[model samples]
Target: MEITILKSVIIDDCTTHRTVLKRLIENHPDLVLEGSYRNGIEAKNNGCEKNADLIFLDVEMPFIDGFDLLESFKKRPQVIMVSGKPDHALRAFEYDVTDYLLKPVSPKRFDMAIKKVQRNTGTMTGQSEDEHIFVRSNFRKVRVDYGDIKWVEALGDYVKLITEKKNILVLTSMKAFEQKLPENRFLRIHKSYIINLDRIENFTSTEVQVCGKQMPLSRKRKSRLLDALGAG
Candidate 1:
């Protein structure tokens, strides 16, 4: 399975810690460093927090402390608290954070924290338009809203995601990519195609049209597709 590419931001008052965390995130394949802020105020004012799917947050900072910063978010994303002290671990849990990373974070521990984030982002499929998944394309994380996707096409070792905004070619097998979608919303109509049920304008016995393109609908899977579309 492909790791979900997280849109990540760092908030730390210490220049040294911020630099270190930034390097680690940049080096990891699953993380895409969106921005690095010296303090909570800088992070807030820049509007980086709103767009981020994950935050590598420092528990102690100027202007607003880490706990206070968590409170400020109208909608908080997955937060991995990074602190120098072990004392705040219990208090941080009350906020329902993804994980807590101690300062001078080791690479091994960092990866473990990431695994939690992956489980949350990967397995859970949301049924609303507000929900989204990040796909790796052109060596960057591209966020695609559930409502925007029209279909997914199998392309050898990769799958081409056809969306309303743009087409993205992700380095993952079709069977693997199919698992990321909500089964009730998406149906595999053929060996080569999985179409968004909401986007279907019309279809025939042999083919279905999506995003103005005719894609082959294998006979074997057509009954399953029909059942999915007919279901509530």
Candidate 2:
């Protein structure tokens, strides 16, 4: 199999930070540094993000902030946010960002983030994830078909997978469980719930119905859900 080289870009206000990021990206075998811009406007104007697969974006900028830059994206790409403070990590995760890194990023941490990007991009190759995935249920491994799954709900440190015939509780975090499912078919619609897009019966701005059960939808994720549904 041919390795997919991810074309990458860096948008940091500090020249030193941008340079450091460029070096790190260049050192990676699976990544290609397409452009390194000093700011969001610079990146946009230079057309650096076209056909780019990844972005290393600084959270704090003068004019267009990191989240604002994310909002302006023509198409969502894997974003690894760089920030000086940890205050934005939770919100950045809400955006479904690949990873958040503090300034003066270590080589080990950079590689870890790259691994996450690889995982995300690799799962997105096919049109659908109509395959079965196994889960640990009741001290035994059980296979669950993708079509059979309706939704997943968080329970403290664990997640419950709701399927047509039965529910299986797995010892995993929502974020970890979400990564196991294909992004095209399953999405984290709320902080506590991930729903199979194919199983959605109806959805308003506030909630979605799956398998005859209504689940709360985060207002922040409503637009993303609509986009996933290809709603016009």
What is candidate 1's CA lDDT for residue 222?
A: 73
Per-residue lDDT of model 2, residues 1-232, tens digit only? 5677899999999988988898998888888888888888888788765778998989999888989988888887888888877667556655677777887888876875676576557632333344789899789999898767889999997899989899899999999889999876788999999998656666666888776788999988986775454331
lDDT of 1 by residue, 119-174 (tens): 55773322445368888999999999876788998889889998878789999988
lDDT (C-alpha) at residue 28 in model 2: 85
TM for every model, in the order presented, reads 0.52, 0.58
lDDT (CA) for every model shown? 0.79, 0.80
lDDT of 1: 0.79
Clash totals in order: 0, 0
CA displacement after TM-score superposition, residue 129 of candidate 1 (Å): 33
